[model samples]
Target: MNLTTKVNVTEEAEKLEKVLFSQKFWIDLGTTSLRIVLILIFAVLAVKIGKVIIRRLFRLKLKGPIRKSERRENTLLKLLENTISYVVYFSAILAVLTEFDIDVKGLLAGAGVLGLAVGFGAQSLVKDVITGFFILFEDQFSVGDYVKIGIAEGYVEEIGLRTTKIKSFTGEIYILPNGSIIQVVNYSLENSLAIVDVSIPFDVEVNRTEKLIEYYLTIVSQDKADFINKPKLIGAHDFTETEMIVRIIAETKPMRHYDCARLIGIGLKDYLEKEGITIPYPNLVTKSLTDV
Candidate 1:
């Protein structure tokens, strides 16, 4: 055959193959749908059976190092479940295409290009997912943990693959991308310190106010079970024009900072009032026109 005739024949064959792949009928739908159904059944069976058997073995309480190891295993199980589901669904798609007798060779070559585009677009997204996985596996934080991560401080509400949900003290929900978290301050990991400031009028008897605070600090330290660390009456934090700022600080358990601060404030108030110590208020002194 002449070169021109051979080129024409190859073009026609390519066009025909395109047309065949694009043609979809009701019969094709039925076949593909059946395959999807079967694959879905297999995925469900795998999850149910795998969880029952694998998780059952972990049912008994583990102790010491074993308990910590078990938690890491749980993280792996969650990752496995996610990976397995996607794999099963992908296998179903390939099977469905094969049923139509479509050429998978060219599809694979096309897939490489498509996958390259997708991979580049999803780099940060994948990083978020991978970092989130490590966060969980390492037990960095858990739901209900009060943490400060990347300037967003709050209690962790939920932990997902790509993001973590934190409810801030201002009642705002912060959805933090895992990849963006550089510093993770897991306050839940250790005891928290509560710091409270109470300024009194400078003209008031400083000795009396100091004594009252000292008395109440003792009472608070002894009464509150949450007070793991004793309260410190930090004497005079600052001397302002209007008042002397007296700060009282206490260290308590993970979630007890708020309550600890409140208790100190209340106890100090009642004691100081009984002792006739004045809590400072902003003063508006008006200079008379005569003085001017």
Candidate 2:
């Protein structure tokens, strides 16, 4: 109740106010913010440098005498880069949170539980990732490979842990989950058989036609490097009332079958016409009832 007591109490209150609103408090906040910014910058740099190192290492591995397919190398490089980025960014986030005195252990525990719950709901995603890993490891198909999956056929543009991107011949892009790929037909894996069917008039001599085709095939094999082997005349494939279907089979380079078949067809037509071989056309005969 005395004046001295009142002055001493007032001095204690002023000291408390100064401590609460001091420049040091603001400076500490600013320093924390700067640390966060620096951490973010380091994270970005880590990702960039990690990517560069990954690329160089893979490049050297690919160039070694052991010899790896380009597609396999590319898939691994992308997978490594993505994994490095995720890990580095996650660590950087934790570091930044620690700078602000946040409880990282509790956050990670919560995240783990949340991830478990999400995992139960996202079984398909996990399946897709597992399937993708198998696809890469087994070398089933790679980027730039022309493949047919179910009804979708196209050149593979990208293969990720969850999905695959394919660009079709008609310029349509298809994104399919890796788990959904049950069967894959890779057209680039081996030589393709070019089958060309030629229809001739039934009246034409079959034996002479066969010999003529075999002779022409020998010429084609010599001229076109795409042809892996000489064409084989498989005799008559089918018989119609007006014509006989002859089948020609040729082994050509992968993906060149269509072109080779087309060229063979043209050449056959030209040769048949030059040799006066008749190609059958349907002829319709109509009789009037009145005349009958």
Candidate 3:
């Protein structure tokens, strides 16, 4: 090789190395990193602010004269907060990818196709979301409501967009998809009726017993917080050979029917016994023949 040619080639190689290790290159890279960090910080702040705003708006709505339930308000607030967070985070991620020179449009197009495929495959999931929305919108049931859906009967612990968590009386938590809930029996919507039957010996005076029970029920209604109205003694309900059953019905607060019934039964028994009324019990007659 000639001397001048070799020198020129060496200078070109030095120029290339200088450009690669230039301060401008590091500065540009640092600027990009700072922009990504700023984007993430803004996204987080936006989500937080959005959530606060949503909660405040819902709180205002709750305090208004329209009078919405606490559970429904909380459910709506949470759903809005989640949606806001998701949107903000997604936008921030897209902006970061753009800073890195990634093709966000192409990525979004591919994601759209993939999402369509997933949506087709997950029809039940879509149904669940749709049903959940209607459940919230229509006020079908709320958190802490005692409900019976299919074979699952429990207090609703959590209601989400896709699933509901119910805690049974026996301490079992049932996670049920919203789409699976077709028929729901919400026991908390109205007052519950408590029916109690007291058995008395056939010899007892029916008219006097009924009057006494009615009086006692009036007293019970006054003392019990659960009672919505005074209980009524429904005369004689069932007749057996040994005893006659008198049925008492009481209107009580929701979920308090069982306790109200139990208290009424005990009070009736004590009162009846005090008034010299005999409560009948079944007798087992055993005949033994030893003479044969």
Clashing residue pairs in all predictions, respectively, total: 0, 0, 0
Q: How much lDDT does each candidate structure score?
A: 0.75, 0.82, 0.83
Local accuracy of candidate 2 as per-residue lDDT tens digits, 1-292: 9999999999999998987799997899889999999999999999999999989998788788897777678777877898899999999989988997999999999999998998899999989999998898778898888788988888999988799999999999999999999988888766777777788777888789878878887787786888887888877888888888888777777677778887888887788778988564312122111112
Which runs in model 2 stand beyond 4 Å of their true positions?
A: 1-23, 26-34, 136-139, 151-160, 163-177, 197-215, 218-247, 278-292
Instruction: Give the clashing residue pairs of candidate 3, or none.
Output: none
Off by over 4 Å in 1: 1-42, 61-66, 69-77, 87-113, 173-176, 196-225, 229-249, 271-292
1 against 3, candidate with superior TM-score: 3
Could you say which candidate leads in TM-score? 3
TM-score for each of the candidates = 0.55, 0.69, 0.77
- By lDDT, rank the candidates, best first: 3, 2, 1
Worst 10 residues of 1 by lDDT: 282-291
Candidate with maximal lDDT: 3
- Which is the winner by TM-score between candidate 2 and candidate 3? 3
Q: After superposition, how far is residue 54 of candidate 2 from its true place, in Å?
A: 2.1
